[model samples]
Target: MESNQEVQISTNAIISFTDSYTQNKQRKEKELLEFESKSARAIISFTDSYAQNKQRKQNEQQESESTLSLAQVTSRLESLSNQIQYNNGCKLVIQIPKLLQSLIALVTFRIGTHLKQEIDLQRIEVRRQSRWCLSSIQVYGDEQIQSELVRQGYGRVMSITLSKAGGIDEEQDEEIYNGLRSISRFLRGLHAGRNNDYQPSFQPLPLLARRSIEQLEEEGANEEIEAQMNNRYNGLIKVWANDAKDMILNCFIYRRRR
Candidate 1:
Protein backbone atom coordinates (compact mmCIF):
# COMPACT_ATOMS: atom_id res chain seq x y z
CA MET A 1 0.00 0.00 0.00
CA GLU A 2 2.85 2.46 0.74
CA SER A 3 4.63 1.64 -2.54
CA ASN A 4 1.40 2.31 -4.50
CA GLN A 5 1.05 5.76 -2.84
CA GLU A 6 4.68 6.57 -3.47
CA VAL A 7 4.37 5.70 -7.17
CA GLN A 8 1.25 7.99 -7.58
CA ILE A 9 3.08 10.89 -5.86
CA SER A 10 6.06 10.45 -8.15
CA THR A 11 3.81 10.54 -11.24
CA ASN A 12 2.09 13.75 -10.04
CA ALA A 13 5.47 15.44 -9.45
CA ILE A 14 6.71 14.46 -12.95
CA ILE A 15 3.51 15.86 -14.56
CA SER A 16 3.85 19.17 -12.67
CA PHE A 17 7.53 19.48 -13.68
CA THR A 18 6.71 18.82 -17.33
CA ASP A 19 3.93 21.47 -17.34
CA SER A 20 6.27 24.13 -15.78
CA TYR A 21 9.02 23.40 -18.33
CA THR A 22 6.53 23.72 -21.20
CA GLN A 23 5.23 27.11 -19.90
CA ASN A 24 8.81 28.46 -19.54
CA LYS A 25 9.68 27.34 -23.11
CA GLN A 26 6.54 29.07 -24.49
CA ARG A 27 7.41 32.34 -22.64
CA LYS A 28 10.97 32.29 -24.08
CA GLU A 29 9.59 31.77 -27.63
CA LYS A 30 7.15 34.69 -27.18
CA GLU A 31 10.01 36.91 -25.92
CA LEU A 32 12.15 35.98 -28.94
CA LEU A 33 9.29 36.86 -31.32
CA GLU A 34 8.76 40.20 -29.54
CA PHE A 35 12.45 41.06 -29.86
CA GLU A 36 12.50 40.23 -33.61
CA SER A 37 9.35 42.33 -34.17
CA LYS A 38 10.91 45.33 -32.38
CA SER A 39 14.13 45.03 -34.39
CA ALA A 40 12.22 44.87 -37.69
CA ARG A 41 10.16 47.92 -36.74
CA ALA A 42 13.31 49.87 -35.89
CA ILE A 43 14.92 48.97 -39.22
CA ILE A 44 11.86 50.04 -41.19
CA SER A 45 11.64 53.34 -39.32
CA PHE A 46 15.30 54.09 -39.95
CA THR A 47 14.94 53.32 -43.65
CA ASP A 48 12.00 55.68 -43.94
CA SER A 49 13.85 58.47 -42.16
CA TYR A 50 16.95 58.01 -44.33
CA ALA A 51 14.87 58.08 -47.53
CA GLN A 52 13.13 61.26 -46.38
CA ASN A 53 16.46 62.94 -45.60
CA LYS A 54 17.86 61.91 -48.97
CA GLN A 55 14.81 63.33 -50.78
CA ARG A 56 15.02 66.58 -48.85
CA LYS A 57 18.68 66.98 -49.67
CA GLN A 58 18.00 66.26 -53.34
CA ASN A 59 15.29 68.93 -53.37
CA GLU A 60 17.60 71.46 -51.79
CA GLN A 61 20.32 70.63 -54.27
CA GLN A 62 17.91 71.08 -57.16
CA GLU A 63 16.76 74.43 -55.82
CA SER A 64 20.35 75.58 -55.41
CA GLU A 65 21.16 74.47 -58.94
CA SER A 66 18.18 76.40 -60.26
CA THR A 67 19.30 79.51 -58.40
CA LEU A 68 22.82 79.18 -59.74
CA SER A 69 21.49 78.79 -63.28
CA LEU A 70 19.43 81.97 -62.93
CA ALA A 71 22.44 83.88 -61.63
CA GLN A 72 24.50 82.70 -64.60
CA VAL A 73 21.75 83.74 -66.97
CA THR A 74 21.50 87.19 -65.44
CA SER A 75 25.25 87.67 -65.59
CA ARG A 76 25.36 86.63 -69.24
CA LEU A 77 22.54 89.02 -70.11
CA GLU A 78 24.24 91.96 -68.43
CA SER A 79 27.53 91.14 -70.15
CA LEU A 80 25.84 90.86 -73.54
CA SER A 81 24.08 94.18 -73.10
CA ASN A 82 27.23 95.98 -72.00
CA GLN A 83 29.59 94.44 -74.58
CA ILE A 84 30.75 96.88 -77.30
CA GLN A 85 31.03 95.62 -80.86
CA TYR A 86 33.25 97.57 -83.25
CA ASN A 87 32.65 97.61 -87.01
CA ASN A 88 36.04 95.91 -87.42
CA GLY A 89 34.69 92.81 -85.59
CA CYS A 90 36.56 93.51 -82.36
CA LYS A 91 34.32 93.02 -79.36
CA LEU A 92 35.00 94.70 -76.05
CA VAL A 93 33.75 92.23 -73.44
CA ILE A 94 35.75 93.24 -70.35
CA GLN A 95 38.97 91.60 -71.46
CA ILE A 96 41.68 94.16 -70.65
CA PRO A 97 44.35 92.94 -73.08
CA LYS A 98 42.00 92.70 -76.05
CA LEU A 99 40.40 96.06 -75.35
CA LEU A 100 43.82 97.61 -74.92
CA GLN A 101 44.95 96.22 -78.26
CA SER A 102 41.78 97.52 -79.93
CA LEU A 103 42.27 100.93 -78.36
CA ILE A 104 45.90 101.08 -79.49
CA ALA A 105 45.03 100.00 -83.02
CA LEU A 106 42.22 102.53 -83.16
CA VAL A 107 44.29 105.36 -81.70
CA THR A 108 47.29 104.57 -83.87
CA PHE A 109 45.10 104.27 -86.92
CA ARG A 110 43.44 107.58 -86.16
CA ILE A 111 46.78 109.32 -85.72
CA GLY A 112 48.53 107.68 -88.67
CA THR A 113 45.56 107.76 -91.03
CA HIS A 114 44.53 111.32 -90.16
CA LEU A 115 48.05 112.60 -90.84
CA LYS A 116 48.44 110.19 -93.80
CA GLN A 117 51.51 108.68 -92.04
CA GLU A 118 52.46 105.04 -91.42
CA ILE A 119 51.44 103.47 -88.10
CA ASP A 120 54.15 102.05 -85.88
CA LEU A 121 52.16 98.98 -84.83
CA GLN A 122 55.10 97.46 -82.90
CA ARG A 123 55.66 100.56 -80.81
CA ILE A 124 51.96 100.99 -80.15
CA GLU A 125 51.66 97.35 -79.10
CA VAL A 126 54.59 97.60 -76.71
CA ARG A 127 53.31 100.81 -75.11
CA ARG A 128 49.80 99.41 -74.75
CA GLN A 129 51.14 96.25 -73.04
CA SER A 130 53.34 98.31 -70.73
CA ARG A 131 50.38 100.54 -69.78
CA TRP A 132 48.30 97.45 -69.03
CA CYS A 133 51.00 96.23 -66.68
CA LEU A 134 51.18 99.63 -65.00
CA SER A 135 47.41 99.95 -64.47
CA SER A 136 47.16 97.60 -61.45
CA ILE A 137 50.66 98.39 -60.20
CA GLN A 138 50.96 100.58 -57.12
CA VAL A 139 53.14 103.68 -57.09
CA TYR A 140 53.74 102.66 -53.47
CA GLY A 141 51.18 99.86 -53.10
CA ASP A 142 48.42 101.99 -51.52
CA GLU A 143 44.98 101.05 -52.91
CA GLN A 144 44.24 104.77 -53.15
CA ILE A 145 45.39 104.69 -56.79
CA GLN A 146 43.68 108.00 -57.63
CA SER A 147 46.13 110.25 -55.72
CA GLU A 148 49.06 108.73 -57.53
CA LEU A 149 47.34 109.04 -60.92
CA VAL A 150 45.88 112.47 -60.16
CA ARG A 151 49.27 113.83 -59.06
CA GLN A 152 50.60 112.70 -62.44
CA GLY A 153 47.57 114.15 -64.38
CA TYR A 154 46.87 110.60 -65.59
CA GLY A 155 43.09 111.10 -65.64
CA ARG A 156 43.43 114.16 -67.87
CA VAL A 157 45.64 112.28 -70.32
CA MET A 158 43.30 109.28 -70.48
CA SER A 159 40.29 111.55 -71.05
CA ILE A 160 42.11 113.21 -73.90
CA THR A 161 42.97 109.89 -75.48
CA LEU A 162 39.39 108.60 -75.25
CA SER A 163 38.18 111.83 -76.83
CA LYS A 164 40.67 111.42 -79.66
CA ALA A 165 39.82 107.78 -80.46
CA GLY A 166 36.99 108.63 -82.84
CA GLY A 167 34.83 105.90 -84.41
CA ILE A 168 31.45 105.89 -82.68
CA ASP A 169 29.20 108.96 -82.43
CA GLU A 170 31.73 111.38 -81.05
CA GLU A 171 29.50 113.14 -78.54
CA GLN A 172 27.99 109.95 -77.10
CA ASP A 173 31.20 107.92 -77.06
CA GLU A 174 33.18 110.77 -75.57
CA GLU A 175 30.59 111.27 -72.83
CA ILE A 176 30.48 107.58 -71.92
CA TYR A 177 34.24 107.14 -72.03
CA ASN A 178 34.93 110.28 -70.04
CA GLY A 179 32.37 109.27 -67.43
CA LEU A 180 33.96 105.80 -67.22
CA ARG A 181 37.41 107.33 -66.76
CA SER A 182 36.13 109.60 -63.99
CA ILE A 183 34.46 106.69 -62.18
CA SER A 184 37.61 104.62 -62.53
CA ARG A 185 39.69 107.46 -61.12
CA PHE A 186 37.27 107.80 -58.22
CA LEU A 187 37.38 104.05 -57.53
CA ARG A 188 41.12 104.29 -56.85
CA GLY A 189 40.30 106.68 -54.01
CA LEU A 190 37.90 104.18 -52.41
CA HIS A 191 40.34 101.92 -50.52
CA ALA A 192 42.36 104.74 -48.93
CA GLY A 193 41.00 108.21 -49.66
CA ARG A 194 43.53 110.81 -50.86
CA ASN A 195 41.27 113.75 -51.68
CA ASN A 196 40.29 115.28 -48.35
CA ASP A 197 36.98 116.30 -49.94
CA TYR A 198 36.13 112.62 -50.62
CA GLN A 199 35.14 111.04 -47.30
CA PRO A 200 34.10 107.39 -46.97
CA SER A 201 30.55 108.26 -48.02
CA PHE A 202 29.04 106.79 -51.21
CA GLN A 203 28.35 110.13 -52.93
CA PRO A 204 29.35 109.92 -56.63
CA LEU A 205 31.19 112.67 -58.48
CA PRO A 206 29.74 116.11 -57.87
CA LEU A 207 28.73 117.67 -61.23
CA LEU A 208 28.29 121.23 -59.96
CA ALA A 209 29.85 123.41 -62.64
CA ARG A 210 33.47 124.32 -61.89
CA ARG A 211 32.61 127.88 -62.87
CA SER A 212 29.62 127.88 -60.49
CA ILE A 213 31.82 126.81 -57.57
CA GLU A 214 34.48 129.43 -58.45
CA GLN A 215 31.87 132.16 -58.76
CA LEU A 216 30.16 131.14 -55.50
CA GLU A 217 33.53 131.26 -53.75
CA GLU A 218 34.30 134.71 -55.12
CA GLU A 219 30.95 136.20 -54.03
CA GLY A 220 31.61 135.89 -50.27
CA ALA A 221 30.82 132.13 -50.49
CA ASN A 222 27.05 131.76 -50.87
CA GLU A 223 25.49 129.57 -48.14
CA GLU A 224 23.53 127.58 -50.79
CA ILE A 225 26.55 126.75 -52.91
CA GLU A 226 28.46 125.65 -49.81
CA ALA A 227 25.69 123.16 -49.07
CA GLN A 228 25.54 122.22 -52.78
CA MET A 229 29.11 120.94 -52.66
CA ASN A 230 27.92 118.07 -50.45
CA ASN A 231 25.22 116.62 -52.69
CA ARG A 232 24.70 118.78 -55.79
CA TYR A 233 26.02 116.20 -58.23
CA ASN A 234 23.42 113.75 -56.99
CA GLY A 235 20.85 115.95 -58.75
CA LEU A 236 22.65 116.79 -62.00
CA ILE A 237 25.17 114.41 -63.62
CA LYS A 238 22.83 111.50 -64.48
CA VAL A 239 20.51 113.80 -66.44
CA TRP A 240 23.49 115.08 -68.40
CA ALA A 241 24.72 111.57 -69.22
CA ASN A 242 21.68 109.29 -69.77
CA ASP A 243 20.25 108.78 -73.26
CA ALA A 244 16.68 109.76 -74.14
CA LYS A 245 15.66 106.08 -74.19
CA ASP A 246 17.06 105.61 -70.69
CA MET A 247 15.76 108.97 -69.47
CA ILE A 248 12.31 107.45 -69.01
CA LEU A 249 13.58 105.65 -65.91
CA ASN A 250 14.32 108.92 -64.14
CA CYS A 251 10.56 109.43 -63.74
CA PHE A 252 10.48 106.86 -60.93
CA ILE A 253 13.13 106.01 -58.30
CA TYR A 254 15.87 108.10 -59.95
CA ARG A 255 14.17 111.50 -59.79
CA ARG A 256 14.51 113.18 -56.37
CA ARG A 257 11.54 112.08 -54.23
CA ARG A 258 11.63 115.25 -52.21
Candidate 2:
Protein backbone atom coordinates (compact mmCIF):
# COMPACT_ATOMS: atom_id res chain seq x y z
CA MET A 1 0.00 0.00 0.00
CA GLU A 2 2.85 2.40 0.82
CA SER A 3 4.67 1.79 -2.57
CA ASN A 4 1.37 2.36 -4.49
CA GLN A 5 0.77 5.69 -2.62
CA GLU A 6 4.35 7.04 -3.49
CA VAL A 7 3.89 6.16 -7.22
CA GLN A 8 0.60 8.15 -7.29
CA ILE A 9 2.23 11.23 -5.71
CA SER A 10 5.14 11.17 -8.26
CA THR A 11 2.68 10.83 -11.14
CA ASN A 12 0.66 13.88 -9.88
CA ALA A 13 3.84 16.01 -9.58
CA ILE A 14 4.88 15.25 -13.24
CA ILE A 15 1.36 16.30 -14.56
CA SER A 16 1.53 19.71 -12.74
CA PHE A 17 4.99 20.49 -14.26
CA THR A 18 3.78 19.70 -17.80
CA ASP A 19 0.72 21.99 -17.38
CA SER A 20 2.87 24.94 -16.13
CA TYR A 21 5.36 24.61 -19.07
CA THR A 22 2.55 24.62 -21.66
CA GLN A 23 0.95 27.79 -20.14
CA ASN A 24 4.36 29.67 -20.18
CA LYS A 25 5.08 28.78 -23.86
CA GLN A 26 1.59 30.05 -24.97
CA ARG A 27 2.02 33.37 -23.06
CA LYS A 28 5.49 34.05 -24.60
CA GLU A 29 4.16 33.39 -28.14
CA LYS A 30 1.27 35.91 -27.60
CA GLU A 31 3.68 38.59 -26.32
CA LEU A 32 6.00 38.13 -29.36
CA LEU A 33 3.03 38.53 -31.82
CA GLU A 34 1.92 41.77 -30.06
CA PHE A 35 5.44 43.27 -30.28
CA GLU A 36 5.79 42.43 -34.04
CA SER A 37 2.34 44.00 -34.76
CA LYS A 38 3.32 47.25 -33.02
CA SER A 39 6.63 47.46 -34.95
CA ALA A 40 4.84 46.99 -38.36
CA ARG A 41 2.29 49.69 -37.47
CA ALA A 42 5.06 52.18 -36.64
CA ILE A 43 6.89 51.51 -39.92
CA ILE A 44 3.67 51.96 -41.97
CA SER A 45 2.83 55.25 -40.22
CA PHE A 46 6.34 56.68 -40.94
CA THR A 47 6.17 55.69 -44.65
CA ASP A 48 2.77 57.39 -45.07
CA SER A 49 4.01 60.65 -43.51
CA TYR A 50 7.13 60.70 -45.73
CA ALA A 51 5.05 60.15 -48.88
CA GLN A 52 2.66 62.95 -47.92
CA ASN A 53 5.47 65.45 -47.31
CA LYS A 54 7.14 64.69 -50.65
CA GLN A 55 3.84 65.05 -52.50
CA ARG A 56 3.11 68.41 -50.87
CA LYS A 57 6.51 69.77 -51.84
CA GLN A 58 6.05 68.73 -55.47
CA ASN A 59 2.65 70.46 -55.57
CA GLU A 60 4.11 73.71 -54.29
CA GLN A 61 6.91 73.62 -56.86
CA GLN A 62 4.42 73.13 -59.68
CA GLU A 63 2.28 76.01 -58.45
CA SER A 64 5.27 78.33 -58.34
CA GLU A 65 6.31 77.41 -61.88
CA SER A 66 2.77 78.11 -63.11
CA THR A 67 2.76 81.55 -61.52
CA LEU A 68 6.12 82.45 -63.08
CA SER A 69 4.92 81.37 -66.53
CA LEU A 70 1.80 83.53 -66.25
CA ALA A 71 3.82 86.57 -65.27
CA GLN A 72 6.15 86.12 -68.22
CA VAL A 73 3.18 85.85 -70.55
CA THR A 74 1.62 89.04 -69.23
CA SER A 75 4.90 90.91 -69.62
CA ARG A 76 5.29 89.80 -73.22
CA LEU A 77 1.75 90.84 -74.06
CA GLU A 78 2.23 94.29 -72.62
CA SER A 79 5.42 94.83 -74.64
CA LEU A 80 3.74 94.28 -78.01
CA SER A 81 3.95 97.39 -80.22
CA ASN A 82 0.82 99.07 -81.60
CA GLN A 83 0.53 101.08 -84.81
CA ILE A 84 0.60 104.89 -84.34
CA GLN A 85 -0.74 107.36 -86.96
CA TYR A 86 1.29 110.45 -87.81
CA ASN A 87 -1.85 112.27 -89.04
CA ASN A 88 -3.43 112.07 -85.58
CA GLY A 89 -0.07 113.35 -84.30
CA CYS A 90 3.22 111.72 -83.50
CA LYS A 91 3.06 109.64 -80.31
CA LEU A 92 6.35 110.62 -78.80
CA VAL A 93 7.93 108.55 -76.05
CA ILE A 94 10.91 110.07 -74.23
CA GLN A 95 12.87 108.20 -71.60
CA ILE A 96 14.21 110.30 -68.73
CA PRO A 97 17.61 109.65 -67.25
CA LYS A 98 17.93 108.45 -63.67
CA LEU A 99 20.06 111.52 -62.88
CA LEU A 100 16.98 113.79 -63.12
CA GLN A 101 15.08 113.27 -59.85
CA SER A 102 11.82 115.15 -60.49
CA LEU A 103 9.46 115.92 -63.39
CA ILE A 104 9.83 112.22 -64.17
CA ALA A 105 9.68 113.06 -67.88
CA LEU A 106 8.44 115.29 -70.74
CA VAL A 107 6.17 113.62 -73.25
CA THR A 108 3.66 114.80 -75.86
CA PHE A 109 0.97 112.59 -77.27
CA ARG A 110 -1.13 113.69 -80.30
CA ILE A 111 1.13 116.68 -80.84
CA GLY A 112 1.13 117.97 -84.43
CA THR A 113 4.49 118.23 -86.10
CA HIS A 114 4.06 122.05 -86.18
CA LEU A 115 2.64 122.52 -82.70
CA LYS A 116 4.47 125.25 -80.71
CA GLN A 117 2.28 125.45 -77.62
CA GLU A 118 3.93 125.81 -74.22
CA ILE A 119 3.54 122.61 -72.17
CA ASP A 120 2.95 122.62 -68.41
CA LEU A 121 4.65 119.78 -66.56
CA GLN A 122 3.44 119.90 -62.97
CA ARG A 123 5.60 118.66 -60.08
CA ILE A 124 8.82 119.41 -61.88
CA GLU A 125 11.78 119.44 -59.50
CA VAL A 126 15.49 119.66 -60.16
CA ARG A 127 17.65 117.87 -57.63
CA ARG A 128 21.19 119.15 -57.54
CA GLN A 129 23.12 120.36 -54.47
CA SER A 130 19.73 121.85 -53.50
CA ARG A 131 16.19 121.02 -54.67
CA TRP A 132 14.73 123.53 -57.14
CA CYS A 133 11.05 123.82 -58.03
CA LEU A 134 10.86 124.15 -61.83
CA SER A 135 8.10 125.59 -64.01
CA SER A 136 5.27 123.21 -64.85
CA ILE A 137 6.22 123.57 -68.51
CA GLN A 138 9.98 123.69 -68.90
CA VAL A 139 9.95 123.46 -72.70
CA TYR A 140 7.84 124.46 -75.73
CA GLY A 141 7.33 122.96 -79.20
CA ASP A 142 5.90 119.83 -80.78
CA GLU A 143 7.34 116.37 -80.18
CA GLN A 144 9.37 116.43 -83.40
CA ILE A 145 10.89 119.86 -82.81
CA GLN A 146 11.60 119.26 -79.13
CA SER A 147 13.21 115.94 -79.91
CA GLU A 148 15.38 117.57 -82.54
CA LEU A 149 16.33 120.42 -80.21
CA VAL A 150 17.42 118.09 -77.48
CA ARG A 151 19.27 115.97 -80.01
CA GLN A 152 21.07 119.04 -81.36
CA GLY A 153 21.95 120.50 -77.95
CA TYR A 154 19.79 123.58 -78.63
CA GLY A 155 17.15 123.05 -75.90
CA ARG A 156 17.08 125.70 -73.12
CA VAL A 157 16.65 123.14 -70.32
CA MET A 158 18.79 124.96 -67.75
CA SER A 159 16.64 128.09 -68.09
CA ILE A 160 13.38 126.48 -66.98
CA THR A 161 11.36 128.50 -64.40
CA LEU A 162 8.60 127.50 -62.00
CA SER A 163 5.00 128.36 -62.95
CA LYS A 164 2.64 130.34 -60.69
CA ALA A 165 -0.49 128.30 -61.45
CA GLY A 166 -2.23 125.89 -63.84
CA GLY A 167 -1.03 122.28 -63.97
CA ILE A 168 -1.92 119.19 -65.98
CA ASP A 169 -3.82 116.26 -64.52
CA GLU A 170 -1.78 113.82 -62.45
CA GLU A 171 -2.10 110.93 -64.91
CA GLN A 172 -1.06 113.08 -67.89
CA ASP A 173 1.78 114.60 -65.90
CA GLU A 174 3.12 111.15 -65.02
CA GLU A 175 2.95 110.00 -68.62
CA ILE A 176 4.77 113.09 -69.86
CA TYR A 177 7.38 112.72 -67.18
CA ASN A 178 8.09 109.15 -68.12
CA GLY A 179 8.48 110.07 -71.79
CA LEU A 180 10.86 112.91 -70.98
CA ARG A 181 12.95 110.74 -68.74
CA SER A 182 13.32 108.20 -71.51
CA ILE A 183 14.37 110.93 -73.95
CA SER A 184 16.86 112.19 -71.39
CA ARG A 185 18.44 108.78 -71.17
CA PHE A 186 18.62 108.50 -74.95
CA LEU A 187 20.16 111.96 -75.27
CA ARG A 188 22.71 111.10 -72.61
CA GLY A 189 23.76 108.02 -74.56
CA LEU A 190 23.94 110.01 -77.80
CA HIS A 191 26.04 112.71 -76.15
CA ALA A 192 28.38 110.09 -74.79
CA GLY A 193 29.01 108.86 -78.34
CA ARG A 194 29.02 112.29 -80.00
CA ASN A 195 31.42 112.36 -82.96
CA ASN A 196 34.04 114.97 -82.26
CA ASP A 197 35.01 114.98 -85.92
CA TYR A 198 31.48 115.57 -87.23
CA GLN A 199 31.10 119.33 -87.53
CA PRO A 200 27.61 120.85 -87.42
CA SER A 201 26.61 123.04 -90.40
CA PHE A 202 26.78 126.46 -88.73
CA GLN A 203 26.04 129.84 -90.25
CA PRO A 204 27.83 132.86 -88.79
CA LEU A 205 25.71 135.16 -86.63
CA PRO A 206 25.08 138.80 -87.65
CA LEU A 207 27.69 141.46 -86.79
CA LEU A 208 25.55 142.98 -84.06
CA ALA A 209 24.87 139.60 -82.30
CA ARG A 210 28.55 138.62 -82.53
CA ARG A 211 29.57 141.95 -80.97
CA SER A 212 27.08 141.50 -78.12
CA ILE A 213 28.28 137.95 -77.41
CA GLU A 214 31.89 139.12 -77.42
CA GLN A 215 31.05 141.90 -74.94
CA LEU A 216 29.15 139.42 -72.70
CA GLU A 217 32.11 137.02 -72.71
CA GLU A 218 34.53 139.86 -71.95
CA GLU A 219 32.45 141.21 -69.01
CA GLY A 220 31.45 137.75 -67.69
CA ALA A 221 28.21 139.23 -66.30
CA ASN A 222 25.86 136.52 -67.62
CA GLU A 223 26.21 133.50 -65.35
CA GLU A 224 23.99 131.31 -67.55
CA ILE A 225 26.06 131.98 -70.67
CA GLU A 226 29.29 131.45 -68.75
CA ALA A 227 28.03 128.16 -67.34
CA GLN A 228 26.95 126.92 -70.75
CA MET A 229 30.25 127.92 -72.29
CA ASN A 230 32.28 126.24 -69.59
CA ASN A 231 30.29 123.01 -69.26
CA ARG A 232 28.41 122.14 -72.48
CA TYR A 233 30.88 123.28 -75.10
CA ASN A 234 34.13 122.47 -73.40
CA GLY A 235 37.27 123.03 -75.56
CA LEU A 236 35.17 125.17 -77.92
CA ILE A 237 37.78 127.89 -78.20
CA LYS A 238 40.53 125.37 -78.78
CA VAL A 239 38.49 123.31 -81.31
CA TRP A 240 36.74 125.98 -83.42
CA ALA A 241 38.24 129.23 -82.18
CA ASN A 242 36.04 132.24 -81.20
CA ASP A 243 33.72 131.64 -84.19
CA ALA A 244 32.21 128.45 -82.66
CA LYS A 245 31.46 130.23 -79.38
CA ASP A 246 29.81 133.11 -81.26
CA MET A 247 27.72 130.65 -83.26
CA ILE A 248 26.36 128.82 -80.16
CA LEU A 249 25.85 132.11 -78.33
CA ASN A 250 23.79 133.35 -81.27
CA CYS A 251 21.54 130.25 -81.02
CA PHE A 252 20.83 131.03 -77.36
CA ILE A 253 20.34 134.81 -77.86
CA TYR A 254 18.25 134.69 -81.06
CA ARG A 255 14.95 132.94 -81.68
CA ARG A 256 15.41 129.59 -83.44
CA ARG A 257 13.56 129.18 -86.74
CA ARG A 258 11.45 126.03 -87.05
User: RMSDs, each prediction?
Assistant: 37.9, 39.4
lDDT, candidate 2, 97-163, per-residue tens: 2212211121111112221222112112111101111111112123343334343222223222110
Q: lDDT (CA) for every model shown?
A: 0.33, 0.30
The candidate that achieves the highest lDDT relative to the unseen native structure: 1
Lowest lDDT sum, 10 consecutive residues, model 1, at 84-93
- Candidate 1 per-residue lDDT, tens place, 104-216, comes to 22222212222111223322332233233223322212323223333433433333333333332433343334333332333333322343432323322222122222322
Off by over 4 Å in 2: 1-143, 147-154, 160-222, 227-244, 248-258
TM-score of 1: 0.25
Question: What is the Cα-based lDDT of residue 57 in candidate 1?
Answer: 46
TM-score for model 2? Answer: 0.18
